[model samples]
Target: MRSPLRTLVPLALWLLCLPALAQDYVPSRDAWSHASPSEAGFDPARLAAAVDWARANGEQAPADLRDALMASFGPREPDYRILGPVGTRGPANGMILRGGRIVAEWGDTARPEMTFSVAKSTLSVVAGLAYDDGLLPEPDQRVSMQVSGPWFEGAHNGAITWTHLLHQTSDWSGALWDIHDWADRPDGDDPANRVLHAPGTHYKYNDVRVNLLALALLELQREPAPQVFKRRVMDPIGASSTWRWEGYENSWITLDGLRMQSVSGGGHFGGGMVINTRDLARLGLLMQRDGEWNGQRLLSSDWIARALVPSRVKSDYGYLWWLNTGRTAIPAAPERAFWAAGFGGNHVYIDREHDLVIVTRWTPDLAGVVTRVLEALEQP
Candidate 1:
């Protein structure tokens, strides 16, 4: 007995809610295992044409660079296999850009894939945008001023601020435990969570602090974090691809919810953001360009400078980014280069002076693949 428009509205909402319905259709591995490239969206004729254009435009690499680069291709890197166990079972893809043009690219760089904690770097950008747009309260503002919920009352949480959260110096303890334990607790107001050290005095990679930051952003914006991201950051940069912020399974929880599952538009805490390699490259390029893209300044140069400056925790910890002090195996040239690295060998290495950005998406390795990649980057 419902009106026709009313009936259609529910049906539309139901269709929108279905996961498979909204996703881009991709061929299953089994279906394309034996198929030709033409059958897999890479038509032979088109590919040949593209190759001809490349040759005509002199886009082919120099003989020596080609050989050196190709040597690292395929599944032959035993050290990488050992270092990244989860990564070897799948494709390892990467892209390299110099002077705003792709110099070398390999593997399936266009596919939507997981980037683990690389999401944190993206979250940092979001915070910068929020600050620029006036959505976020001032960075020095006390946490107690913004969030009045039971979590910040009369404890170290009250003393926390956006600056402290960004630097991983919120002084909160009991955050080192696995995420599942925190998710299962019912009382959001537990006093056992106290300051282990004064804010800005120490550094610990605490997921809870970042998760709380995500919550604060959501509360300030009054919308899901991803939408805010799209409007302020991603779309402005011309990345139109769909990405997701994964969460725990069942029962939609806050960004900090324990049992969340991977959802399309969610918060930016621990389990958020699944983007394709191409978009990831775009993001790196944006950062490398000092927040400018296609002739527009998305973020102020001053802001980027501040974000890349090291914090008190480490000589390398920036606003959420990681600066390379040449301490890691990766000999970051010019010593001004920085990176946003994640578990399982995901990395976005940005060198502003060199006008270079390198993005790698690889399986988790047990061997020293990370060290080898760093060595490769240091190549003369």
Candidate 2:
């Protein structure tokens, strides 16, 4: 129902042998590459029909998405300094990529907007970068083992591992950026509920805890997470620079005598990822190529493999990313097909079987999107 353990796990053993060369791809279009639907063996009309379904019947999840936040955070959370209006969603937009080329698109694909939890996927990539640089000693190694200082102190928090944080199962109890782990989506009505569990024992989608993960990673890297991501992952992948990852004002900490911001895992507290669909599509394309953009290995297939595999607590969720499992999330998608989903219907679907990457924003028809895209690829 959500998204780790501690051991001095050996580092080298965790590194799986990946293909040395991941073919590099260049974008034909500045925004993205383009291809005819027929080039990908897809029916143009069927694809349009699917896009039409989304545009015609799509919905905004309503202000309750923010109403709950406002209620929980008091009009607006004070620490959420770099956020947007409560419950903001842009006009519907989407893009389809096949063979790393755009097959179709609609709406204002370039307008950046809040992407909610998809920031977790972005964070996942940063984690991948950390591993690639050998900063993370081991995936199963305790976060406490890597990060030092009062931030990750305490036996309960010390027991949590990187794998647990990635899977949203760490159950790390703490308040970061003024957002309490228990204040968000409590299993019951009590907002002040104090039933905290041990680390890695439960699965809960707590942004406060996720933010803790961001902070811990920040301390471990001793740099702003966004800059590291930009230099290591996004720039190499040629993603748009307009996209921004937000962090709370209070989340700022001076590291190595330099001030830095620790970005949150998602927009639950208002500060998260604000990115355009084209940028998101680029991200999907990178993932579709199995952590390769064209051919340069920006992300290791080893990390991607672990990131996509289902976690122990949630069958339909992988490490921060969502998986198509148990016929939930997207029954129309293949089991191997995974997606980076955000609140308000934002999705970056990775259909490796079809070499397809689809990104949709603020649409209610994920099933229609998947079904239509798959149907088009099947047509004569």
Candidate 3:
């Protein structure tokens, strides 16, 4: 017969877990519940001030993104021009989620807007899905093993790996969609003859190389990445159909008798994700919860852990996701906090320690907005 102490011990443990279990929440497709600032452990006035401050500090870029792109890169890069589609944008907007419920919001949170480099984070998630399905056995696996193109050929590019691509250290040379790799934020005036570092030896932020990764993943999965992301991630998380993933007009390729367009990793050349703040918040919530939605496991926890590990060359970056490692990036935020950032001041911040997901669009100062939100939290 079991002793009375055994029964009491189990009951006490269950009681201890009750609070945590109650705090966990996942919004459904049709409805999203809301919690007042005070109810969500925030000072109501302070949270409101933060939202107001963010709205006033919208991006300084031109409303016409094509003009903005040209003004930003045309002067620096030789022959730099938009090769993909660009469009006008909406006003500043965003939402704040505490414990999976909205605590405060402002602007047109439902309006879809171009989220430039933030799409790289979405690409990272799609890669994580490929990893889960055994399509990619190891991050260190050489890209040449799976991809049958000249993209990974030659001694320098031949040595590149999936890890190198994800960390932005591949230093892959060449052009895709007629845009040369050296033309992207080139170092020296002579970009065409710029020095090439061995793969994995140096870190460089290059959109052309990122697009190569998208193409490689397309080859491995033999399907469009957006489809994989929708079926495995977005749909399970109850994301609406408003979000879109796009690539350059010339980025199309023929794979196994099917013509498929490879997606871009950012909007530097004018193609990436255009998504609403609410759906963007949902992605953040999924990352905050370790890729688990409700009771379903979407991405393996192992993949997320690997993705968050800081790269050797860049301590503040991890698998396309930006980090606040050592509190260097955002002093007010926790070191474990990570985010997906885009041009035109779009960002989705996931604060795991505080159970917070803050989405801000067209807000120039992300750190300032985040600091304001952190200050509003009521101390336990």
Q: Pick the candidate with the highest TM-score.
A: 3
lDDT of 2 by residue, 252-280 (tens): 88888998888978877677898889889
In model 3, where is the ten-residue run with the lowest total lDDT?
14-23
Better of 1 and 3 by lDDT: 3
By TM-score, the better pick of 1 and 2 is 2
Candidate 1 lDDT over 68-146, as tens digits, reads 2234322332121111101111356666554445545566676665565677777787778777777654787886776
lDDT of 3 by residue, 90-116 (tens): 788999988788888899888888899
Alpha-carbon deviation at 249 in model 1, angstroms: 4.0
lDDT of 3 at 264: 90
Error of 3 at 69 (Å): 0.7
After superposition on all C-alphas, the RMSD of every candidate to the true structure, in Å, is 17.4, 7.5, 5.1
Task: Spell out the clash pairs found in candidate 2.
Answer: 3-167, 3-168, 4-164, 22-295, 23-294, 23-295, 24-294, 24-295, 25-294
